[model samples]
Target: MSLPLISRAPGSGRRTRRLPLGALFASPYALFLLVVFAVPLGYTVWMSFHRFYFTAPGAEVDAPWVGLSNYRDVFTDPVVQRSFFNIAVFLVINVPLTVLLSLVLASALNSKLPLRSFFRAAYYLPYITASVALVAVWSYLFGTDGLVNHALGGLAPDPSWLVNSSLAMPVVAVFVTWKNLGFFVMLYLAALQSVPGELYESAAVDGAGRVRTFLTVTVPGVRPATTLVTVYAIITGSNLFSEPYLLTGGGGPDHASASPVLVLYQKGIEQAHPDFAAALGVVLVLFVVALSLVARRFTEKKEG
Candidate 1:
């Protein structure tokens, strides 16, 4: 019976009988992307090209399409303009400083220091905790009559944090840096560990000091990683949302910290204008993409 079964030719379906479990698992995600991500993304672009403010609570804003009107209005809206400007300022201040700090910490951790793992873990704890919790802690520290002012004993805090417009954006940046610092540290640490020990040893033998070897050898070896981390920061930073949302209480202190995502949230939930909110989303996506591309080019030039 076995011989007879072996003599029979396998059918076309049976010829490839084993199922591709990987594809089966992956297809749902692929389909989910098309359905959830691609479809919504395309719809948002369509919505962004039109005027979509409230005509009434229930009535449509425009019966006819108004191409690029929403985008024009988005740029012109005082709040929207301020948000873009604020994010630009935040990125300018934080990105470079984050890179520099991460590198320095990574270099220090790479050395023959005592309690190396303990220090590394301590530095990385901020990254492990939820940002929402971190923002809450920061809130108390910056409160009008909170610990910071109390610690000053007699000197005034001048203007209250969490309420002062001038201090709002920078306070937001500090929270961002604290939460983000560990991620970049981990990135740089990984890159540092990958550098060939031989390279440093040889450089040292040739009279290169620690600082000199680091600048010429360690830094160069991790250039690609440095580029990747910077670009990642730019992308993530451009999408500033939860940090400002929690830290500034939805752009409190007269909306000084109202980031694009907060703006989008107001449009959708507060304003009940999904179409307009969708437009805000489209613009945010474009900004991140463009900024990432620019960063990539800059990183490439440095490598070249």
Candidate 2:
């Protein structure tokens, strides 16, 4: 019998095989990831465990070992606790409101109605507008004597929306929801479109009313989109920074609206405590990971 072509010599097989030529094509991107993402992440982790700071404005390297002291301080710090509380309140309020309103707006837009396209574009316009410009417009409307107060018609006093500690975080959450609503609406609209028209027709043939059809057909059909929207809303709501920062500077009249990112900014850039900021950033990443895991569990459960 002829020797089997599949057989390999033991020593010959031990020799390393060359990487595919496709890896040559991927080299640049791999290098970019290593340089841009991996290196910085590694450096941040290294810095997080040490007392690191620039000796001068241009200095790049000066860190003394501090072990887990920064992390310990991060957990014990009152400002950090306040920041977490602020993010918690924002997430609790913003996520549900955003998801619900977006679903409604998407369903409305998906319907055959007059001026639907115009309304879609109009709603999406806020999402495309510059953040600073949006903030300025919101600030104008929320001014003590401005349109919102004027619209109230003396039903209530014109409270300072951005200045009041209790109201500031809620206002920020609302602004975030409004700004991002259109994006989520677009997501749901796409999901709604993907739902088969046959399903709706069948529901109608079965004597199902609009509400019944919606709950049984429409909602379940878009479950994936709902999960995506919920997870996205959670991440964005938890990481809210710019709205609060621009609306009410320096943590909003008693650290009322301070997000973890704002705390990182204050510690790293403002106070020259990069090590502590790195630790805070790591903690925030862990928080996001844990929340995302819980969300994933719920999503998978619903799917099951």
Candidate 3:
């Protein structure tokens, strides 16, 4: 017997499984992270637990598992300690200077000033320029016999800027701030443009001057951007390598300006201690994460 056909509403009775558009769109980036970051990070962690070293193709290798010995050694190493200390000094100088300069420059650029576009481009030129070229120019300008010394004469330091232990890291900090300032200033400019015109008008109505308006309205309005800038500054400051590497000549002058990344390269590639280098890398990642979190929390609290 033929069964009577029953009329069913569309998409009724049977469940229609729809593709997740969000995940579908995000899969490419997910795959990229898996290949680029996650896999390498997992391998680094695995290496950190073993005394691993590179070997010839098809060669039998014995990578003994060393547990936390690498971490212990990293902590005890004096050079590593000095590298961290140097980084701390760099951050102390770099972060504030970068933030202050970026805000000031961004504010100025945002105003109705003559040649605003020219000044903006001029400031941003150093940021987009090659780091090697910039460092070469900086070295020429700051060398003992360079124009700066010639201009200063006897007032120049006895050992010069990059050569002096006390001056080297600070010099690197300044160089980094100057090099990266344009990028940060761009960020601040975006943030500044978003601030409402009414706030400035209100401040003016209340007899607030430019300086007071900046402190009271402009600064507060850019709190979110401040958080972003601070976190970025800390992360970049912690990963400091290029400036010290190039400007200081591979963290030279007795390693006075050696950063953790530079030290990691020296240990891993130069000294063939991949295990120790992995440990240092892990520690540096953790340190940067912690600092970023602390900075975010501090800024968020102030924002609240």
Candidate 4:
């Protein structure tokens, strides 16, 4: 006779419930993730350590091994240095501008106004459009005979917004800010709405004006929203490939506006050097991760 089911010793492992193996069987997706993302990332790391050229595969001779030489070369390369410099310039001008503009616009939209909904839609219209198409429109708008300069009535020369190294990158930043600000503003507006009216009422009774209440009360109240906007800005800003690629068209003249991502693309595609490209990818990851950490540290919360 078989032993009774409850007769097993409780101290033994037999009493513990066994989970269904069917759940573990799961989807092919789990294996796919392990294969696709995990494998590629590992391969990229390995490739970054080696100097791989396409010709190396065809040549029966031993390919030269280069360990971290590509990374060392990137650090010393003037072109690479300038690309980072360009990114710095962009961030210096746009980061604050973007955050501030979004906050101000969001507050304004939260205010009572005529055709408020219509205006919100109008402002957000650019964001929904295709990036490339909007960028094309931006190119024309800032062109010599474009509407903006024409509207200025020759007050400012319509400098080549897409061609000039000094002005082109800044213009890209402004364009990016313009398009992106709407989404951020909506985010802030929602946050603002969530703030209690009682706090504003109490602040008003305490003789605080709109600006004062906003500075002391509203801003402190929306600290989390501020944190969100800031991190979003840094993350989006690092992925500066599309703007540089389309606006400057492969880093512009003399590689003036070569974003890090753009350089990675050029290395892999134009130069056909996957090894160097992988090195750039690793560098790009470090840059993004560093920026994220910096942003997190900057937005560190204090407990009262």
Please tell me which predicted candidate would have the highest lDDT against the true structure: 3
lDDT of 3 by residue, 177-267 (tens): 8998888788788778878999999999999998999999989987766666666665776577778888888887888898888999989
Model 1 C-alpha lDDT per residue in residues 1-304, reported as the tens digit of each score: 0111112335567556576886897998999999999998897787676555546677754535877667666677788777777776677667777778888998888778999989888998988898778888888887877788788867744677677787787778767877878777877787787778899889989999988998999889777566665566556655677777877778866778777778888766698776667777888888777866665565455434
TM-score of 3: 0.84
Clashing pairs in 1: none
Task: Point out where model 1 deviates above 4 Å.
Answer: 1-23, 52-63, 111-114, 153-156, 196-199, 202-206, 293-304
- The TM-score, computed over Cα atoms with residue i paired to residue i, of candidate 4 is 0.80
Which tens-of-lDDT digit does each residue in 55-150 have in candidate 4? 645576444678889788778878778877877777776778877887788888887899999979988998898889987888788776777777
By TM-score, the better pick of 1 and 2 is: 2
Number of clashing residue pairs, candidate 4: 0
lDDT of 3: 0.83
- Between prediction 3 and prediction 4, the one with superior TM-score is 3
RMSD of each: 9.5, 9.0, 10.4, 9.6
| TM-score of each prediction | 0.78, 0.82, 0.84, 0.80
Q: What order do you get sorting by TM-score, best first?
A: 3, 2, 4, 1
The residue ranges of model 4 lying beyond 4 angstroms of the native Cα positions read 1-26, 55-64, 111-116, 194-198, 293-304
C-alpha local distance difference test of each model: 0.74, 0.80, 0.83, 0.74
